[model samples]
Target: VGAALAAAPGADEAYGGFVYIMWGEKANCLSQVAHRNLETLLSAAPNARYRFFLYGPAQAAGYRIADGLSKVQFQRYAKRGYDVHMRLVNARWGPYAPATGVRDAWADQTNVGEDWPGEDRPGEAWWYAHRSRFPYEDKKHSKLKSVQPHPRDAFFNAVVHMYLTGGVHTDLTVAFSGLEKLTTGAEAQYAMYGDGCERRDAAYDDIITEFDGWDVSLPMALYFPDAGHPALKCVLDKYDQAVQNLSGLDAMERYCLTPQAPNGFPFYHEEEPHEGDYEAPPPAGMAQLRPGHGACARYLLETCKAQTELQDPAAPALKAMTVEWMGCDAGFHWDQWRFPYAASKPFRELAAPEGFDAAGVTGVWTGAALHGKRWEEPPEEHFISKEIYRAHPATRWDHPALKAGLLARQWQRENAIADVEDADRVFAEDPDFPKCAAALPACTSFFHDFSELKDMQYYREDAPKSPRNAAAARCSPTLIIPGAEKGASTFLYSLLAEHPQMISPLKGAGFKETGAYLAGFDRPGQLWDKTSHFPLIRENEPFLTGDATVINMVDKGAAKRVVRDNPNPKVIFSLRNPTDRLWSAYRFTFNVYYKTHLPDLSYANIVNDSVDGFGQCMQRQLSGAAAAAAGAAGEDAGDAEIE
Candidate 1:
């Protein structure tokens, strides 16, 4: 036996090494067997090392030692230098306790207000801390009869049965003996164990002597206990029958539920066949050859065929083959007769030429009058009456030519023009104007107000410049005004465009081309670059990112000069009301594009969806904004501010 134990793998290690043994409650019989095996092994290899780590129902076996037996057999072995160390390892009954705390923590963070009870639960903290931890157990153990296990002890008994048999290993079992005592107490006259302790002692003696140092790990069939413990044996038999029944049922279900082709017959009951099949009677308006079996009248048959053709030409064509094969003298042959097909016709075609003449038809014309009759007459009363125009000569300048002359006179008064004659001389001397004049109609006025044109030149001479470019060129530089959406920034851009040294996209091609050249992308092509090139540094502002290289503009001198050279260099960050902005965001997210291009989400869904769902989407937007801003600032600031 010692030689066999030495040959066993994992047996030659140090004495008292940890050994974890686990078995369920229903496996109580294994406890004695395991103990017997351990004793055998220790006897064979007295110096072998091991510690017993008992878990599940196996732990209960350690508690089962009789008081007398512990002092005698068990304690004697311990004192006899047998190396056996036993310990209990805890088993989880349910999910971890920290998981429940995590759920409560989330609930606390999402609290809203008084309108929602689940969110604003001021009482929940105490309740969760004290009571919510074990709701199922509390309900089960409650004293009130109405609350007791829902339907008395039967429910709890079933729950226990499920816990025992449903793949859960626990250290407790309600055996037949225990249940009999619970149900009938001391009243029922049934022995707790069949054949009593004497029979059990005899059976144990026989089994122990024949154990023969057999390896417990070897596969061996388990047998039901003999009649000495009929109650335990009966329970084992019942469990075996249940397992066999389940396997048989599974096989039967697989066989019975296999799909079969549907029966060809329709679902309804079949009609009984007649001994001699009866023929259907001829339809109405037919001439009877035999009173009930008659040939359809020629007109009726023809009319039906024609109606069928009108409904579906193919149906008549298919019916034609059958009709011709029958060879009945019924004059209903296809194409033999024509049916009057009714359709709407134009009524005017039937009318005489003289009737159309009497209807007074006329051809389309572009002339001001038809048949030499005037359509529009000169106004008898003008919007500016002659007396009013004469009374206020300045107001008569509403006429283009008169307005130009008046503007010239005003310019002369302001000393912006040398004289009215000088204004006329400039207009006449302008090479561009004469080229434009040739294209005008001979009768139309060409001379117009030049005052606006003159004022434009004056403002153009005062524009700002970019300090970086000015320093590079050793001269005052031009400021660049970027375009933005409807906001103070846009207004500032427009205002800055009026300066002579300030180059803006709003200006002519020269300035626009220059800015585009410096940026290395076309003016319109770099629309997306606006975010990075002109980032919004303020909260609630839209951060732009047009392209990659815009960060180079953030240097100290460049940043200051970009701001200082322009008429209004300070960046104006415009923010609308929060509600309005939220609404706009909802619209843009759900509706701005064509139906197919738009997202499937509705505005209400966006506003009323879960906070986590909305938070996730906003988190993405915030991240994108942070990236854009970081790119512009040439720094790695994350989405902290946006979040």
Candidate 2:
């Protein structure tokens, strides 16, 4: 029993206490800025132990960063005679004790299809877990059940981690500037940052600003003196009940759940009676809205709000002390900087900053914790650099002028703006020029219609309709290589280009294929005529042009389109094994799209990792395709065996 107890976390005093940070599903790898901030935090807080709960399929690089930090953190504190432990923990392990067999096993289940109209089919434990992590409701049905897009998983995890280990709980973006002060018992039992939950009414505390709403503090940076706090337990109990209530509903019922308004807005479901058989007014009393009954209702009313006014015995011993300081000020948070308007001076001053950092008055926001849907493409690195942060396009004096200047500079980099004429040409050509000009001072005067001027300055010879080519007759490609991607299409194309008769477009003009037809822009635009691609070809030369668009093989209509465009066209397709092609495509996509973003993730790890979402997707596609084929063959798809 002693050995077992000793093995458990929070059992030893060597590592002063735990500081838990939830790095949500989106962040597969730590950015350069996050790494620097974390290193600084560790250096500042030598005594406190840190554990980052990383969610999702994090790349190998992220683990390397964690592993590297863990190895070196001990050395930093050894000289000072303090125990240091910094490591990463996969959030999949969950906070539940082994005694309670409530593990998330939904991923392991096969053929768990979409929620259709059906009988009551209670969700698995894993479904509940998934819903908690991603809590946005379907909102199709009239009955509203869910809260707005709040990070329920992170919130619940914060409470659980603090309740169990008893220390500071923070979002990954939160820096530990004042960790030493807070951890040394200088602060109250419950300390929180109040940037998010600012109360405007006099009934609450008058800290006047545009933000007037609920008095609920965010879990972005929460600190508890000790483990087993009744308030924390109350939160966990309420949250668990909410999760259970969701699991009771079948897939259809879950799908029909309407999302509630933002935290401060009037929750219509609570204000008005829900339609149909459930017309009872929501219970106002805390006890009346206990675990099994209206856990969600309770959550909206009491649990999510600041518990200061709660007269219940479990209410905190003292009102949680609001941590208001320079670095701790929520206004300088990284999230606000994502949008141009939000980061503007007007919004920054009015919105009332809702982010906190421990780095003091540096005012440089770094790190992203709330994942949402940015996994497909990582967040833009506009403000990551100190230079870019300082030159923030939105927050500048005379926002339009600054944006114009930045836009002009960007344009100048791409196309030379040597003089007024060059500037006019570049500005006219720039895609962003129209939008930027619309917002600029005297926008109409800044841009001019140069069409007439260009037309007047004509040459002696009549201008050709398209770019110069071997002959006017040689407009479209005589050869079309409909592709099998990852089937050595480029290699084949290069070999074919070596022949004197077989000419290919220059690298600037569709090196592999113009992709005009592939992109569905089969019109007389920039990428339409073959003459535009073979500009340097000698007039009257007998040369055959070809387009090797690898994706063309996948599109059914590409052949018809190619044949219609060219009179005497020769088509070729280099087919590869489907499995090998898919694997190669996966690797290529990972390398081209995700490798730089998630450096540590190995393709092998991605293939081996839990959650075969891709496989499930493929299964659905194949099933649908089989059903379609059966239908085309005039057979009943219901009885047809999909092999």
The candidate that achieves the highest TM-score relative to the unseen native structure: 2
> Per-candidate TM vs. native?
0.15, 0.34
Cα shift from native, residue 344, model 2 (Å): 3.0
List, residue by residue over 261-340, the lDDT tens digit for candidate 1: 22121211122222223222222211121110111111122233455457655441212100001122111111011110
Q: What does candidate 2 score on TM?
A: 0.34
lDDT of each: 0.24, 0.39
